[model samples]
Target chain A: MTDTTARIPKLTRKGQATRDRILQAAVELIAERGVVGTSTEDVRKAARVSGSQIYHYFDSKQALIRAVITRQADAEPVPGRPMMGALDCFDALRAWADAAIQRQEENGCRGECSLGSLAGELGAADEDSRQDLSNGFLRWQGLLEQSLRAMRDRGDLRPDADLGELSLALLTALQGGTLLTQTMRDIRPLRAALNAALSYIHSFAADQR
Target chain B: MTDTTARIPKLTRKGQATRDRILQAAVELIAERGVVGTSTEDVRKAARVSGSQIYHYFDSKQALIRAVITRQADAEPVPGRPMMGALDCFDALRAWADAAIQRQEENGCRGECSLGSLAGELGAADEDSRQDLSNGFLRWQGLLEQSLRAMRDRGDLRPDADLGELSLALLTALQGGTLLTQTMRDIRPLRAALNAALSYIHSFAADQR
Candidate 1:
């Protein structure tokens, strides 16, 4: 992040809400039309913000895109549970998967995973953007690993199980399942992939945990 | 596909080679710059094709993208053997995973799965494009199922194993792993995901196949 991004001005309460509203609108527009298809004018019109307001909160379109990435990383919880942070237990993990799947369905599988779309389109496009995406994914996997490690400490997982590999595998299944679900517009692949992952994790559980 | 797509012109021997050249060039350009970033003029220059020639073969840019999807679908083989088609036996499946992993490393994970990038960018943008991408995924999955069913008939798999669900799970893992690999620029996640998937598949092998 540049100095400008670092100082994305925090506003007074009213101005902060306006900033958030623009970010949400940008996310929806980009999700619907793709980055190339969306323009600053489109976002300004959608958010009911003036062109100056967009420039005020975001240094440029890339900075705005980065903010969207930050917003997505913050969408970790579903309802009341910590989707990745508390995923050590089976029920918690299952609930997280359920929330992920339900979000895809409820959205009609239309918009890209706010962060995932950036990963695919921007992963290879630029160094800074790719690093941002990589960090986002690692942060997510770290949360998953924390929960799995918690399980291991509780005698829930085998001492021999590789938590690093397991966490990577689960996140991989998720990214792939989410991609397929988005492409095919069917929830089965995500459900199956996660089910297989849950079963694989269960195989490591000590006496069903 | 429109009538124009159905009748994408077949050419004389030299003409066919030129068409192939255009497609290969388009794939590279799009992979590097993205669909919206790449233009027909860029393809014409990259492939050394005349403007008239591009128009003669493809009706529009969307048509060219559709052809790219078809080209990607044809990239299923890892080596001399059919990768997904012969994924019935354990060694064959492992080799296929190894090949997929190697491809990511060899390519420096620069491009999203050609098919997957399109799926994310175009899946929800338009209906016709989504159908084309959906067909591409189903065809790939069908090849997977064929070999899996072959294994079942040969008594390699447990009688009760749900091949349909298993295949879906495997593909899901692959897509997820590939996505992570692309994002993180690390080969470990793809390797881990595929290994987990293969282990999950092995759990259903009769006498470990």
Candidate 2:
């Protein structure tokens, strides 16, 4: 058989830069115009790359979408959380929620979270995209579940409370609340929802001294 | 000014049928391909109508999108108690959740949600569509809040609990959980999340038995 390796082109540093530019432009365009509204030409122009260059980097629009999914999946809300495992109390949970909401709001909900938007826009057509989204959610849920388990072990939460279920509820509430806040272009409702959810969380934890 | 009312074409019986066919096709296409993937030509083929016929009913693609949003806004999950004002207790609240989730599942979580898809797809380009989606969400929240308030009045929930806040949490959980379920293409996670939220609700309510 012919050497299959010969067909694969390796990206040089400059070629990689071009790819990054294309992806960055795509992210912005997707945020502003949505997956359907965004066109390849728009991305090509936005990235300042020629039409040929775009094709060189991505095989198809679907390939570009996969890139977007991977890029967003790797993104985090903040730089540091190395000690996330150390946060084992209800107070820690409340603080985390505050910080998360603040960062999301400061962004003005304009970035249009990649996973959230994907879930809304491409939930039906791309199974691979769906799996990527599922993995992202599961990753987040696992983090929360780990934190909750620590809290339970520390007697911060009720010993019998189902951490998996609790984690899912909290995650779901946060995502849904964000969607509502974005749609209304207001944060008051989100604040109310978060505080209410926090109160529920508190009730499950051991009483504060 | 000349009377312009007569100039507006009224849809005849056959025309109405064609319009409905177009709308139905549009809904299915949008749900599958998102707003970006759907085209007038695509819709024409799905509806088995000529391209000119589509223009006759809708002036442009944006007009068609507006019609879709309006149609979705008017579509509500039935079989629930009339608003939150009439909900007297926890049983009424549970019934509402059941109906909401049932309808959501029956719809197969198509395209995350028609209104949500529109909101995510249109972004800042369509202010009116955004407003429509925002209004629909608010109306939904209002209905839930009214139900929670009735529960509080009936002493079914803690007197100190904020009905408005709780309602927001409930709605957020439902929306987020449904979206997550859609993305995963599995109902177990959604069921778990909802059951957890419901359990939390029960914990907050005053003991009836």
Candidate 3:
């Protein structure tokens, strides 16, 4: 068995809870202060763990960041719906956008977006972080692509439309809009941008009909 | 006159050079270590300035950051090409993109984009910085809109296409692609994304008779 599996077998319920708490604290702190700004001490205080305990759980700060990225990837909503691959229409896509915006607002744009922050900071720092971030983005793009392909297959979109290109466009629009909204601390620009892009999506459907 | 303008009038040539040195050092450090990670001591060492001299030029770290932002913005490429805005063609647009990418690459994506970094970091912390960033983006977008309008008038692009929307789309794509490119430390993805976007733009061009 791998080291991870070996460790997993030894982790008690309490140990598991402590690990979860550490990961949660890391996420929140990294989001608020950014990767470079947040120190190990800050994570310790946030998690209410001692310094030794933190090191015990993870070998280094980079390892902790890796864990956070993994957690974020696991948390991503399945394409087309909250549950796995259920909804598959324009409305489903719209609903997903709405939920995403609401979640960002609730967070007050304080936390660096996990994937974006990781991509921005560590992806360039080291090979491991680069691969981690790239994989995360690929998975994200994959999720979106899955949804687009489903919509296309169902005749909700033009069959001839390039699904890969459309998926990239959608992800780019969403990400770009989020960056603007976060910096401006206003939802209007994001709403306008998304609405404009969605209108384009609608046009594709209309043309098909 | 504002306090800054009033004080600037009294600076000796030597003092001006010193100030320039400080700003240059701050920009380099910020690019290397990021805004939050860089320290006043680091700036002083990089500039070969004593702590007292550093303080003489700027009151605080925040002040130093603001100066760097102003200087970087001033140094950015002039918005309109020469000859009474006569440079209006696909070649001109491509030239602009090439210049932008070159400048960004030279800096190694070190600090957040000067404007983007300020907008992301201080846009919420201070009103003046917010205005500076917001105005910078607005001006950038305005320049693009003007170019798009010219292209439309020349029968290069579809007359019915929304210039404002298209301008925003182009700017957002460039910004988003830069962010990803810098973080990944690989320009290949950015090249792919940009090419895809440009192809889309080309598809909107007026067809030959």
User: Which one wins on TM-score?
Assistant: 1
**Poorest lDDT segment (10 consecutive residues) of candidate 3 chain A:** A77-86
Off by over 4 Å in 2: A1-18, A48-56, A77-87, A111-113, A207-209, B1-18, B48-53, B77-86, B102-113, B158-160, B196-209
Interface RMSD of each: 1.6, 2.6, 4.1
lDDT of model 1 at position A10 = 62
Question: Candidate 1 lDDT, tens digit per residue, B29-141?
Answer: 88887777788889989998889998877768988888888777667724456468887688989888888889889988766537877776666566777778777788878
Over A1-209, each residue of candidate 2 has an lDDT whose tens digit, in order, gives 12212344796889878888998998898877777678888989999998889998787888788777767756643325533344577777777777767866797755374667766777766777787778777776777789889888888888888777777777666666666677777775556555656666666777554
DockQ of all models, two decimals each: 0.69, 0.47, 0.26
Name the top DockQ candidate.
1
Clashing pairs in 2: A36-B36, B84-B146, B84-B147
- Candidate 1 DockQ, CA atoms: 0.69
Sort by TM-score, top down from the best: 1, 2, 3
Residues A17-48, model 3: lDDT tens digits: 88889988988877666676677788889999
Off by over 4 Å in 3: A1-9, A77-89, A105-113, A121-128, A152-162, A192-209, B1-7, B75-91, B98-113, B117-135, B146-166, B188-209
Candidate 3 residue pairs that clash: A31-A111, A31-A112
Model 1 chain B weakest lDDT span, ten residues long: B1-10
- The model with the greater lDDT, 1 or 2, is 1
State residue A75's C-alpha deviation in candidate 1, in Å.
2.1
